[model samples]
Target: MAALITRTRARWFAVAAAAVTLPRAAALTARASALTRRSMLLGAGTGALAAATSAAPALARPAPSDGAWAKHDGAFAGVEFDGFKKTPSGLEYKVFEEGYGVKPTAGQGIKAHYAGYLLDGAKFDSSYDRRSPLGFAVGTGRVIKGWDEALLDMRVGEKRVLKIPAALAYGKRGVGPIPADSTLVFFVELVAITG
Candidate 1:
């Protein structure tokens, strides 16, 4: 009788110990799995939803080709203008009105009223709508690379149509109103060299 009770108590203690340890072990495993899943999501670029609002995504896109530049709608859509000039860095622009006003250099304060568009003639943003000119320091990394390069070449009051490649404009991740891997166009007018 004594031996039977001792065996029963030992068995119960073992089962209880297993029950307690099992849950802790399972909880630890779940935590580890959740951490690994989160890391994998970040590495794969399907980043955390909260982070996506602030973080610029990795450049998963390649340098742009001429396909996006195919005009979907515009008066000059089908017209191949000979005046389109290319910069060595692949920015394309055609001058509409070359003003005699001041041209900006590096670190110069400049202002412009511009309409931004995607290649499909979708307007994304415009300072013109707000009745205000956009102002920024030229060549100071304050703006996108395409904008900085364009601003440097532009004189105040000059108007031009710009075809900015994805790499120069937004890379793989575009900001608000712009889509990922997009090529952009702009009908930009240099309002003034603020400096």
Candidate 2:
């Protein structure tokens, strides 16, 4: 499944306008940045990190071939993942649109949009409402565990439904709008990968 890249692929496609180069003098500050190498190293972080690999691994199971559903089917707020695939770390995802574009590697910057919901169908957050994608370094703990694990397997422009277990999410110490131990659901689309 391959085709020429199109501008209409995802919401709005845009890569970094310019490659950022941090001055050597900022090395120490960079080391102290939120994504420190010592803290991140990925797999060393948790079971979720075990999902990261050099190449995308085969999905344990794939969703229905039909791929005929909208993001608001309300299936995301439930625990059932009838046609989803499971990663080694317990993250469940259904890839509705395969982008066949460049897949992000560890430490690479990614731009993605997401709509987050709770198991009870309560809405929490969404990048769509913001009209801008979220940016972060994949597999570097800059985001939640499930996100870090899933993004590595996703290619730019791919859209997926993710069922994130509590362990791979905020866990017992849930953040605002999310109850403790609450599993999360998200309709995520990879917009771009840069740096």
Candidate 3:
């Protein structure tokens, strides 16, 4: 009877030890799997960030083309006419209607209505469409070089047509709807000198 009880107690202790050890081993395995999943996710996130930065180009102004002058001259040929006078900086203009009101000075503000077009006659922008006139300081670099130079000498109610060279307009890389190396034309009406 004593040998039977000792054998039964030894069997019970072995079964209890196995039950405790099995649960601990399973917990360790689950912890290791969770760590591995976290590492994979972190690595994937870093790779995606690197790929996104490499795929996008840096934001910077494009360099002007060497053939800007040649392109401007070719575009100018289409509108070559008498009475158009060229400024020292290659801006061509013709005042179709003169105004008697005060002309805007360099720092003075002016209101104007304008329509912009490309050399091929495609309209790019216009203040008339929006029923709003543009207002800016004259010769303050608030606008393109051509507008700055022309507006300083313009008076209120004056209407002029400007043929802007590429350098005086949007340069080699033009804005939306205007192609690279394009020359611009504008029919500008000086509505008022606000300042």
Candidate 4:
């Protein structure tokens, strides 16, 4: 009787182990199958179909080259102003109010108040409407690429106007109210850095 009980316990343990291992083995097999299929498709010159079927976000439009900003003639066309600076990534900004405090680094949470508009002066979004500041991590792509690049240089209490090209803002597929390939203007006030 004692030997029978021990055998039963060992069998139950083995069964439980197999149950856990089987699912993981199945998942790995499925992943391998998908990769093999993708490889075959690529070799067959069906790269586009393979990419479309893959789990990557489709780029709505190609990003403009960094030098493309020089030739850009959009809403900000012919507008000249002093103190405006351009980043290497083509983001442009002018500080209106400078604040004194520690500047936020990448991955730090920041609170900011902002009103976003199209170049034609149509307001599309505002934190003021929600009666609260927008909060996001600085330089971590939590917001748009432009915001991530611009916020890094800002100090607490700083107010600035950002002229974001379409690629940095939303690419070709604009958000609800904003139109595709639209240039955006944002009046931003940094409220706090709360890492």
Candidate 5:
């Protein structure tokens, strides 16, 4: 009887030991899994942050071909006519009468009233109704070459119609309400020149 009791006690102790160890092992495994999951999430978040930081400059940079220019005189050039006054640099415009103008210098700002339409007379953009001049920068590739040339010779209070070639306008990627590579016609009024 004594030997049997000793054996039974030993078996119970072994069973109790196993039960306690099993819970401890389970807790350790849960902790490890949680740590692993946290590490993965942190790594993914860091990678995303790095990618965005690296790409910011590229996103801010403007494209060279953003604004189209007409091919004239064997160069991607533009022409100016009557009502168009050329500046001393022969690359700028200061209008003294009613006519069209283009903005030059890849990044000068312009304040003008404008009426834009398709060559077929389909109207697209207009600022006259707002009784406000539209402000835009030159060559920062906002406007095409034709517009740059046209604005160069225009002055405050000058208005004119402009015929823009496809090469100097939207090119293949036309903007809202404008077709790709379609010639544009604009009636421009120079209200101010702050750039």
Candidate 6:
């Protein structure tokens, strides 16, 4: 089941990097400095994932360089996934049937609140207690690739469930309470978007 869901998500990951990168070059014209830092952070995260892989022998494995099936199967690769629909902007997402909002975008700076949980349904991080929006640039690498992808096709006032595979997430050595090679789930709300 998890494998299926991960394969589903991996299918979207390829399109995600392209989708966000295309819009970013032009959009960052006015905010070059901030965008640069965000890009650095993202690069750092990617580097971290690579480094994490070498840390634990239990987590050591080659990743799929192409296709969602291969990516998920090797990394997070199996299980059927449901719930989100693909949009023209390249985001596959669903609004909570009981609530409302729009998809997110890469260039839009967002003020959001979120909670991160492991596949076993254990919560790792939450913004509710902080009573504040966690500000971040959507696709510039300020956050994990899963988040960068999930939040890119949204509009203001949107909420999303970001189902993340281990590759787009912590990869091998999971951060803090998250386990090595863990899959993550996030409930995120875009409270506001600012220039």
Q: Which candidate is the best by TM-score?
A: 2
Q: How would you encode candidate 3's per-residue C-alpha lDDT over 1-195 as one tens digit per residue? A: 999999999998877666555455445333323332122222433344334333323321112112111112123334243457899999988764455556788988888888787776567787776667888888889898999998888877666778888899888885888887777878777878787
lDDT of 6 by residue, 1-195 (tens): 999999988987766555544244333322322222222222333344334333323311222111111111112112323535554433344442112345556676777777676756567787765666688778898888778876665555445556677778778976889888876766666667664
lDDT of each: 0.64, 0.64, 0.64, 0.65, 0.52, 0.53
Q: On residues 1-195, what C-alpha lDDT tens digit does candidate 2 reach at each position?
A: 234446444423323212222352244223323232222221133232222211122321222221122235333322345657888889988764565556899999988888788866677888777777889899999999999988899987677778899999999997999999998988787878877
lDDT of 1 by residue, 56-158 (tens): 2221111111122222344234233345689999888876444554588899888777778786668778777676778889899998898889889987656
Q: Which regions in candidate 4 have their CA more than 4 angstroms from the true location? A: 1-83
Candidate 1 differs from the real structure by a C-alpha RMSD in angstroms, to one decimal, of: 23.7
The clash tally of candidate 2 reads 0
* Poorest lDDT segment (10 consecutive residues) of candidate 2: 59-68
Clashing pairs in 1: none
TM-score-best of 1 and 2:
2
Collision pairs in model 3: none
lDDT at residue 119 of model 2 (Cα atoms)? 68
The list of candidate 3 runs beyond 4 A from truth reads 1-80
**Model 4: which residue pairs collide?**
none
Residue-level lDDT for 62 in candidate 2: 23
Report the Cα lDDT for residue 186, model 2: 81
**In candidate 5, where is summed lDDT lowest over 10 consecutive residues?**
62-71
Each model's TM-score? 0.59, 0.62, 0.59, 0.58, 0.45, 0.51
lDDT of 4 by residue, 28-58 (tens): 3344334432122123323432343342222
Q: What's the true lDDT of residue 84 in model 2?
A: 74
